[model samples]
Target: MSDQKASTRRIVVGVDGSGPSKAALQWAARQAELAGGVVEAVTAWEYPSFYGWGPAGFDFGDNAGAVLTQAIDEALGPDRRGEVRQVVVCGNPAAALLDASRGAELLVVGSRGHGGFTEALLGSVVQHVVQHAECPVVVIRGPAEATRG
Candidate 1:
């Protein structure tokens, strides 16, 4: 049996079920493989407000966890699934992603997202995470088709 200590360097990746996020997952997987580390695939979600609703009405208590799990499965597939752990948090996407990145060795995210124009500026989750994460951040844009399978 090998005696090498398993690396503790964690990689946090933000995924929103978009093409660019998928590309980021792929890139993060390669990095995890190289570093002998695991990837934390995170997805932050918030429910649309209902008029004058109470906390119970607006609560997304367990839904976020399910969403994050589904996203990780869709992004990583069976082959790379074992290398990733899914994380879900409530609140703003950028804030959640950045908070999750606190102790990470590297935080990876896509350059764009489902949020249309908001993502055009620094409002992009990737941009915000890169700017605020305590660790190194990597933004992955979808590769040219020539590089894709």
Candidate 2:
């Protein structure tokens, strides 16, 4: 339907099952509601490999899909999930997000994801996407946790 297509603004968001990612998803959903846009929630995963072992014959594709689904379910919840389109791809987070963001009006992502450094303000993936993505990027920062004085 041309009417439906015309009314829908396309928003792409990255989700990695992290707290900030959840916040990003919520923000993206709210933005979509205000703009009458549809959100594309993307999660990127790579094949699991062990250095010591040669091959485990693990089903990484299924696992990747499941992880992406879980992230979407957890982030969007039931009420907002219908407004989002979920995508799981096997690649780097930045590349996947960049690919998904083509022709999108906006791109949203968490400031930090499942990175090792807890003190990091920005994850490498987020930084890469911000620099490379064609669309405008919105980085969602999670609420500050209470710090021990």
Candidate 3:
């Protein structure tokens, strides 16, 4: 009998439809495959200001959750879908991701996101999560070749 025991780890990855986030998801999936771990793909969203007030106000929380779920599903297709658990949280992206990172073996995110130049230092979510999360964090950048493409 082989001495190697099944090693299971919990990996948390944040996704928001950006190229870098997509890269992070792909990297996280490969890591999960290697370690025999489960991947938690989390997406955080909040109500849009336009819908937060007035007579036409709509509760965007559920919609946001649904969008997040879709994004996670797209990231992990049929073959690897079994290893992923999708979570949609209502709050600031950075705070939600950081909160979710507790006790996780690895927390992965993109170097940049949909936030644009306002988040130049490091994408806000990645920066905050890296500063506060208890687990080791991985920030994936677009491939060097892809940058030129």
For each candidate, what TM-score against the reference?
Answer: 0.72, 0.78, 0.75
**Candidate 2: regions farther than 4 A off:** 1-8, 49-57, 113-120, 145-149
Worst 10 residues of 1 by lDDT: 1-10
Q: Model 3 over residues 4-121: C-alpha lDDT tens digits?
A: 1124477888977656776788889899888878887888787667654645645566666676566665666656644777777888988888777766789999775334454446
lDDT of 1 by residue, 1-149 (tens): 11221346688898776667778888898899888788888888876676356565445646667666666667677666336877777678899888877777899987643344544443356666776788898887664441223
Q: Can you tell me which runs of candidate 3 are displaced by over 4 Å?
A: 1-8, 53-59, 113-120, 143-149
By lDDT, is 2 or 3 better? 2
Which candidate comes out best when scored by TM-score?
A: 2
Q: How does each model score on lDDT? A: 0.72, 0.78, 0.72
The numbered model that scores best in lDDT is: 2
Candidate 3 — worst ten consecutive residues by lDDT sum?
1-10
Residue 57 of model 3 has an lDDT of 47
Q: Which RMSD values do the candidates have, in order?
A: 6.3, 4.7, 6.3
Error of 2 at 81 (Å): 6.6
lDDT comparing candidate 2 with the true structure: 0.78
- Tens digits of per-residue lDDT for model 2 on 1-149? 24543456888889877777778888998889888789888888875466335456666666777876787778677676337877888888899999988778899998743334565557799888889998899998865541111
